[model samples]
Target: MPPKRAFDAELQALEALRQATPEEALPHLTKTLTHRNNFLVSKAATLAQHHNLTALAPNLAEAFPRFLADAPKSDPQCWAKNAIAKALAHFEYQDPDLYLIGMRHLQPEPVWGGNEDTAGPLRSTCALALVQCRTINSHKLLLHLIPLLADKELNVRVNAARAIEQTGTDSSALLLRLRAELASDSPELLGACYAGVLSLEGPSAIPWAARFLPPEDDAAAEAAMAIAQTHTPEAVDILKSTHKRARDPWFRKATLSALALTRQQSATDYLLHLIEQDTQTADAREALMLSAPSPETLSRLQQLAPNPNN
Candidate 1:
């Protein structure tokens, strides 16, 4: 577990941010980022946003003579960069201002993302900051980050895919390439790709994602249920077929319930059977019956298969 001091310090910093002006927060922000201790490193970026210093993105991008004057004073490059990214997000797309000042250093690299060793938090922080800015600079970020889809670390790839999804580019080629790059052999990678494509949604799901999901995998079942929730007539048919083909009965039932929605005939018997199952998943079974229930549907429940538990 992380130490309690970490949480307390972060809360205190956020509270101070709420109370102070950007200039006032500047000293504290710098102190946090530049601190020799690693404890404050994670929060530096978040602190920058709280002060609304993001409007200064232009100056920070170009000279940030202030931030640069201090960048060297700060020990970690990651900490400094993250803080700037947070500030840019606090403002929205104007990150070029900050990126401009740090050109020499940033030019060679462009943008940053998670790699094998990184925890998901920082990369996600950067991606969301970029997306909220909604600038073209971030749209171009895909080129820099696309490679990380195959990152050795699972969480890194997860965050990378999430970032791409946030950018909301339906780079069919990119998504397909990532899908092809992952083998059916590696279920984890398949799971990640499934998540990645599901995030993309739309008709893109049909030909592209159909192959990745097979009947009965818990993850695939979940995806089927999710697709059913879209309520597109075609999506509904596909989900129904997907569920029928699915070898996992319980998950298949869940998929049917979601697809059925107000269409009671579709799930009526299956849900009633599940509710009367007298099993460990009884809670889930009961919840499904309760959600999206119809009185016409309830009439069938009275005739449900007898269960000792019921």
Candidate 2:
């Protein structure tokens, strides 16, 4: 059969299995997990995860390394391996060894100018999974995760920071703070690190994060937004203070936007006060709308800045 036709047929079969009873689907799903076609294997693995089929855990585990053997040819974009790893993680399969192998796997596939590592997603999935393993101590987990913070892929680095955050130890928070200090580029990575520290240390780390809120860089913007996500009274006050001190128009606007995201009554009140001003009104309204304000807040917005269209 043509590859497309074969793929279509396999998909239809998987869909049918999805609608079948778990008992009826089990054998077929298990067989499909071993299919040579990566797409088919991915679909089967997703179905297993969807069904919570704990019985297929070993099958998924076995299939992961098969595609990793000659990854570009067998798994292409690491599709099969990524899916299988996710399924095992969903099962909460507690083998740090499997996750460690995947977390370190780098599949550099041919692209136009150069090769891009297709296994970044697989590494990210495995990093998150590795943290969840009950057998590994926090120190070992952080040791494994720290290298990923400097991974070639931005998403891999970001998720490594997030996985570190999940460890929730003072050591993990310190690792994040250290990464935040050393990272000069990639605001998203900095944002993840900032969020991790704030999450692990709570409001007290607010002062440390606030230090990054000056100089009007993307890192500063990330800091502002991270601070805003805390949604504490302290967060609101710090953002309010930052907004007042900001000289750059873009940074000032960014601060207002961050304030809206706080979802605090005080932040809402500050934004409402800004809406009354001629210069700040449009930016403030745009910020509130983007925040997805509560109904009462929306009503207040409608009153103050009556939509010309309405």
Candidate 3:
């Protein structure tokens, strides 16, 4: 086993390499790829990817077989596989075999304890990586990924949903399946399904999604946020209606929070107005923070705060 000091040094070196430009650090990074330590190899892959080292494609391609062959028997190796997939997804290189490997990893395996909840991190990472595959055969890969929408693992389902959404293909059946899954009650699942639906059906999804809003015996904050994210005239109207009708303070706050997601000036004006109201100032402030308010919104928030100097 490597000594603590040696391991620490290796970590430091990888961090330094990550900060270095590809041009200045490619030589050292290429060497690190061959390191016996899985961590070092993973780090090298990540840094190469972050730098968009297209020049390193051949090296990454060479590393793919080793990463897949090793098969991650333990947690650390599993993490290494995840890192490798994460990096490869960012590579400009496109290979059908590599994409297939990613797809294979997305399938629930005995390694994942027969449940997606227990699936190794690599499964989720691999699912996401497959989405980045841009070959002519990529759409075929996506068609196979549709089954993963109902994956027991939230991570798998969410990533798969995002991948399908990115294709800009209609996924109404996929959305219906996701909504039927018992785990769809999860806020994360709802958010992913909504994202896919919005991409597939646009404003048409608003009314469909609003049925889950106002938290009727379920936490629908994410669903409401999804509606707000659409930023359509219809969506804004729904948010306003939901907020007006919300009887529970928490649900009201969630509705108000979702409104912050809209780019519409009306939404911002409402939030600003809430910030001045005694009953809503606290929730409004929190909602604005969550929304990542724009510069103009920031100035307005500062002006509205009782003590802007603070």
Candidate 4:
């Protein structure tokens, strides 16, 4: 029972964490997990997991049961189960009971609240939780997730596809079929489904993801990102070429950013080369700033700077 009006202050603190580095925010987030309020604890768990604070795993694991026990009999606005499941998933918790309960509780359509979107977060997160189940066999998790592909909520269906992807299931055929369905029904889901295929098939997904790139459609930026995320040698070459050839500055910048996300030596070298050239330095520098700057980049920036003695 945190003091009344704590939720507002808690929310503000959470927002501040977005700007704060993980190192700076971990202490506050850890303290928040010990708070009595369910919503605050759930939020802290989510923040910790998002920051990849593995040190907080034991705390999150202990907190999950308490959060579950405190869950409202009816669906509440500050639902904790979804957040808890998200945190636990990051820690690779292997509790089958949690997964089973999540699967069982999922409704194809919203059963609570006046709006139909209310249940999407919970059901979708449950699908995500299945993907993170470490102790269970992948096949078993697959069995639980496959049915969710047909869920009415886009979030649930997309997450289910992602879960299947995480299970290393050969879901190319299913993914293609779902892509076609999403093409007609829900365009937003198509990107995630394609990403799932990439995760499952790796280079095999290049052809499909590439179709979304320039001259064929308006999804070139997105395709560039998806391809870059693969972090394969082929992806690196493709991204470099895409950045060079793209006429759209936004598209070129997107490709550069994607390349930076890979954080590979070759990618960093390419960016460094771009920054030395007059034609592309501005955009390359911007993207490099957005990336996790490497030691080489720091050294280069220093060399490029004017000496105070001069």
> Which candidate number would show the highest lDDT if scored against the true structure?
2
lDDT of 4 at 91: 71
Which residues of candidate 1, in runs, are more than 4 Å off? 1-38, 41-45, 48-87, 96-116, 127-140, 177-181, 184-192, 195-201, 249-310
lDDT of each: 0.52, 0.91, 0.69, 0.69
Task: List TM-score per model, in order.
Answer: 0.58, 0.95, 0.78, 0.61
Clashing residue pair totals per candidate (backbone < 3 A): 10, 0, 0, 0
Candidate 4 lDDT, tens digit per residue, 99-203? 567654532223566444444677777677766666777767777876777777777777776667777766544654466344643544566666777777788
How far does residue 302 in candidate 2 sit from its true spot (Å)?
Answer: 1.4
lDDT pick, better of 1 and 4: 4
- lDDT by residue (tens digit), candidate 1, 105-201: 3211123663222223344455445445445554476764566566555655565666666666668335634654555434445555555565566
1 or 2, greater by lDDT = 2
lDDT of 3 by residue, 1-310 (tens): 5698888998898898767877988998888777667677778888888888878777766766665553543324454556666777677356656655655553223544453323335556666666555664545756667677656667776777676666665454364435634543467766777766875778887887887775643446777878887888787799888888888888888888788888777888887887777558878877887788888888888888744347
Cα lDDT for residue 219, model 4? 49
Best by TM-score: 2
**Residue 295, candidate 1: how far off, in angstroms?**
11
